[model samples]
Target: MRTGVPLRQESLVTPLRLPSLIGCALSLALAAGAAFAQTGTPALPPADEREPIRLLVGLPPGSGVDRISRVFAEALSQRLFRPVNVENRTGARGNVAGEELARSTPDGNTLGVVTATTMILNRHLSRQMGYDPQADLTPISRFASLPLLVLGGPGQGVRTIGELIEVLKARPSTCGTPGAGTAQHLALELLIRSVGARCDFVHFRGIAGALPELLDGGVQVYVEAAVIGLPLVREGRVRLLAVTSRVRSALLPETPTVAETVAGYEAETWLALMGPRGLADSVLVKLEAAAIAVARDAAVVRRLRALSAEPIGGTRTELAATIRAQDSIWGPVARAAGVTAD
Candidate 1:
């Protein structure tokens, strides 16, 4: 009787355990499927079958755009199992590179890392822009957004936005920008207009040329990408008065935002992946997938954060919407400010 009872119990438990094992396996398979759906599979050709990928950058090497482009290029090379190279095509406030990208073969081999200035502002500021951002380029994804830092040089005696305003009211001040129609210049113009302060803008060919002027008081204030200005601020060479973002930066929580001081003032630059118009849908899918993957990566997020940039990943539709929205906001502002590149 005891042996019969034990066999009956074993039979019942075995039946339940088999079902439990099967359920666990199914759950794991479903989880994997969900993950794959979110990230999407790599759609580009295998390394052996594909040509080397070129990432075209509009800014000089060591600029914020160039740095971010190289980071993404490295991450993409690993993820796509292909050799990725960064080509600096610096000129025309990023228009030279934009034209090159617009003329490239749309076979997934050429991609451009562009900013708001490259895609939206340049066209509004210059009539002779060689390529139409909306028509000549296909946005793959917007990968990051960088806030601008309003920095005061040594001997400026102004450590806060309020003090800067006071100084401007008392005497005219000059702000250094990287270029005439660049985002930095636009941001400075917006700030001046918002506060009704008196300031002149000095355009430099690049930030490297602008920094020395900033340090020596050739320029009283400089508005530049945080990635480029934060290091100098940290070294005690410059004072960070405010960031141009609507909110304070995570990397500089103690620093205030321009909007906090001057109502309705907010400006930030963004980076996007784009290809020449007429790119194959297949190529776009693969490039977008890789961009989204890199933008979502933990290491990439950490690196961008270190540079005071916010990582943003989204679809082509979303990127296009961003471009359109920025154009709508900045176009009128540029025209109002008489900001023409040529």
Candidate 2:
């Protein structure tokens, strides 16, 4: 026979209902206060929530774009009372990070540090990109511009654009690109078509991959952003034939402009910080201010110049207009060049 022990009331302890009630009430009140605080005003960051500001880049580590973004991150952290973090999400010629940024929340927390190639050229190249650079992304600020330089490999013994043109006329030489449909490729295309120069085109995975071929005398000339070309010029690994922009680069002051010889030649690449479109005015304003302040910093300017980049800070409207202008200008050029994304 089983004997059932009498159950004691005290044995079954009840939870502290009063404390739970109090906690729930407190949580509701705090949430209500936050909601009320944000009701009429822009969703300003909570005063106590010092979350990290993520600046996403589309280039690999140690790249000029990455370096400039990191430098701005340090400067922005000082300007904003929060930590600034840079994340590299490289692929699709920078369209990967551009797409990510375009689809991200427009809360001013996530930003894309992008170049004109991603903004202007990739659209012309790629047929099925996930997002539209001009439509999905809001350009908050233009940070910098990098001019491209036309350089000659050892085979030509060419010291100037004129000499290089002469050599190309004498014999067919090939120019190298980081890849097809890149800004570098477009520059070479324009150069070749403009002057009717005879040259074959070679595509590499990146400037680094193509650089070895240049050094081995496999490619005679390459048009690359000064950030990539300046180092080789300094090391005597390559000779700068000419820069594309009208004015000479501060980093390579001695290198003359191809524009001087081939008038109307310019392929200056730009870098900017942008966020998802429809970002609230308040958040957009703060981000724009932060970016402009960082670009205006003397230290930032010096560091950017060291990378052969020029710092340029402008309003959202200004950046948007620039994007539109570039789209108009390069869209036709890209089509004419028969550039397609790989």
TM-score of each: 0.78, 0.80
**What TM-score should be assigned to candidate 1?**
0.78
Q: Write the per-residue lDDT of candidate 2 for residues 86-113, one digit (tens) a residue.
A: 9999998898899899888888788889
Worst 10 residues of 1 by lDDT: 5-14
Instruction: Provide the lDDT at 229 for model 2.
Output: 74
Per-candidate local distance difference test: 0.85, 0.84
> Which lDDT value does model 2 have at 205?
76
Q: Give per-residue CA lDDT, model 1, range 288-335, as digits (tens).
A: 998999999999999888767888888899999888887888888798
Global CA lDDT computed for model 1 = 0.85
What are the clashing pairs of model 1?
none
